[model samples]
Target: MSLYNPNRVNPQRPKRIALVIANPATSSSTGWPVGFWWSEVTHPYYVLTEAGYEVTFFSPDGGACVADALSDPNDASGYSRHDLISQGFLHTPELLARIANTTPVQDLVSADYDALLVAGGQAPMFNFANAHALQQQFAAFHAAGKVVAALCHGVALLAFTQTTTGEYLASGKTITGFSNQEEDQADQAAWHYGWLPSGQSIMPWRIETRLQEIGANFVHAGAWQSYAVRDGNLITGQQNFSGEATARLMIEALGR
Candidate 1:
């Protein structure tokens, strides 16, 4: 019998990744300027780019996207003061240049990239949830057996996404997002808006509930656990503190 040669390399080209950012939008609940969380975008941008994967930025509506006010270096919240990853992106001219100019999501089709990264923020809860166009785009990418990663509120999109086969995309996947405890802390600190109605309890509005409703195996590991979970090619991070670890996990999943 002929010897099998496992060392043979395929002629296919190397894969490229695209970072999909939420277009700048205002928070309906809080009336605050909101966009993708800084660390969620920057940390992953740094990770994927350094892995030598060509990364392109895009927004749901296509245009310049802003970072959340709390994520801004000058924000009074000071909640993200210890985020060196975000600070580095703020100061790095090259990375800054990339974000300063982003393409619209409609401009690029699923064929343009090997993977799609959905960055999160309070903005997604308001805008991304109802963005049918964006949900379709992500479903397309996931159906192709390509990687799909989302962090914090970014995973909110998964709650409504359906595969081309018409099944809930997250139906059997394990995922995580911003926890109820974090929401409580943020509301207590900012007081601009409460995610739950008075006496409604945080349980109903938790991302875990939404995912569970869609049949996902969900996990919530307290506030700021630096927890990132990978299921198949679908990756998710708990919240802001999990950004770096999430990025690293994405890098590992992409094998780049």
Candidate 2:
């Protein structure tokens, strides 16, 4: 005889999310310091935590992570002065500590979280595309039928990740990332601010172009628009402004 009662009800476990950020690195293109975008990390974190999801931070090489200079609200460029969310996160001791030292990406397991979000900034344009370990972890999450998400330049990983079957992970998927128009605008801004030599691009590669090259059905909204797309379990954001939209899509995918 079975010991279980048919009338018994069990409580559901809270959803767990793993947020992967890039460690600080100097941009090969601009020689500028780069890391995760402020809004890309804080906005989604704010939304996910508000939904009661448990979120953890991780990095490809582990240890402390930094935010891009322009993404910082206090940056002299004043590019992100209106980002109160990022400003609050930078001031909160507890939150600030979370990014100080992150778990290594190699330590992650597909079974440990319900979803994975790769946050982005200028650093990811250099760091994430060729990180084999990070790519494997991201592929593992997808293979396990979990929600997989990437925002802005973080989506560059999708262009290089392969499925267990050795096929491009983004093949035939409808996705969106930092678009060419946005990249052009960013490049222009960099030159205008003397951050880069005249007529030079700020990033080594363009996320949208890469995804398209990998056979993804790349899509996007207007430049700098808050836009995200969901194609089955894959969720992608257009740029920094789409962080919250991407997180909400992940929640939707997880049925939370």
Candidate 3:
């Protein structure tokens, strides 16, 4: 018989991870209150939890997360219709509660977990950039040789985060995020993103552009394909499709 039990719940194993999210914020381009992406959160959450790691949701503002309507798997636009993983998460009362009430990111100390995963959404463009506490957390986790995973726009956190040596976190890191071509593809689509007063893209700066500017070796595959890269313990996923890929890498890194 195998010593491991897939159905066993190890309550005291001390294997915990934090999923960080952005509080609701206005999308500069669309003017909508944007929060976490459904697939970016649910897909990775599914993979991590099924692997038996205790996951906790954290937010800078500490409250309920509002889904980007376009990312809702059941949304009428059908943009994310194939996202049955998220569809199932939406239906789980207990799982749904985790996203509905997030613990404040500030309340978490470095000793609280083994790793951290940042979730993507339009809100990150508004808030995750240059947040001191978050940057510190990134540094702390990486310094501890623990996994630091970020997906989609959430990867933007590394663009401005720094090491104690005062270098940008992306300085020598190989990372990926929402790519430029993909953004251009979205721009040309029929989706109704809010127009800026200047009639330009609502996001003042692009995630890929900022990452490159800060010296990260950004990489990507096809326009909408799932792509994730692992550099040391730093893991980054390109977009929604990359979430589970990133999570799997983290599972290996955690040795779980």
Candidate 4:
């Protein structure tokens, strides 16, 4: 007969990652349906999981989540037709179910995971920045010295998040996100294709501008380039294309 020890540590336990995605929303600036970007979530999820980390999906408001239309490979626009990773994720039942219904951020406990990642898309611009519960969870992960990462517009949360001392989390930290140039290009394409009103931008606010305003040392590469920044335990990707790079940086920070 053997007695089980409740407090025994399992050395073989896999590292867990909490991936926070934005819930569906109608973009006020463009009146367009917005949600998490396909590549932003799929790419990082692929990378992290391939590295043997257990990944869980979460959102500010849980339930079902949608992807930005243009980010879908099956979208008529063919905007993301080349995104095979996203396409595969969409086709896989288990992977697709991860985003179908997500755990609400309010239900998350920072101590339960080894790292936290926020995937970006247009919806984040409208929701993530103002979501108090999500911000607190992000801050909690940072305070716990866990790797905290964000991509594209997901970085919006970093601009408003605060440290325990009440200072902006990004203050003096080097970070990158969807840049003004990228936003301008996207808006121009939207207008040219009649998807956006003439003379209107697709986003209510720009991540780069807001982060710079908050005292973050914002840097970026050319538009659509794969660029990621690692400032201590904080990691950020420049745009959708930088997802894998960001995940790799997070893995590095985790010493895995």
Instruction: Write down the RMSD of all candidates, one decimal each.
Output: 6.7, 5.4, 3.4, 4.5
Error of 4 at 79 (Å): 0.9
**lDDT computed for candidate 3:** 0.84
TM-score of 1: 0.85
Measured against the true structure, the TM-scores of the candidates, in listed sequence, are 0.85, 0.93, 0.91, 0.94
RMSD of 3: 3.4
Q: Please, what are the lDDT tens digits per residue for candidate 4 over residues 34-145? A: 8989999999988877777778899999989999888999999898999999988988997777688899999998777999999998898888757899899888888888
Model 1 stretches astray by more than 4 angstroms: 1-14, 191-205
Local distance difference test, each candidate: 0.76, 0.88, 0.84, 0.88
CA shift at 249, candidate 2, in angstroms? 0.5
Candidates 1 and 4 compared: the better one by lDDT is 4
Per-residue accuracy of model 2 over 1-256 as CA lDDT, tens digit each: 1123322232256677899999888989877788889899999988987776778999999899999888999999898999999999989998788899899999987677899999998888787766889999988888888999999999988978999899999999999999999999988987887878888998888887887887999999989999999998989999999999999998788865
Predicted structure 4: lDDT: 0.88
TM-score ranking from best candidate downward? 4, 2, 3, 1
Ten-residue segment with the worst summed lDDT in candidate 4? 1-10
Give the poorly placed runs of model 3, Cα more than 4 Å off: 1-11, 190-199
Clashing pairs in 4: none
Task: Show pairs that collide, candidate 1.
Answer: 62-104
Backbone Cα, N, C clashes tallied per candidate: 1, 0, 2, 0
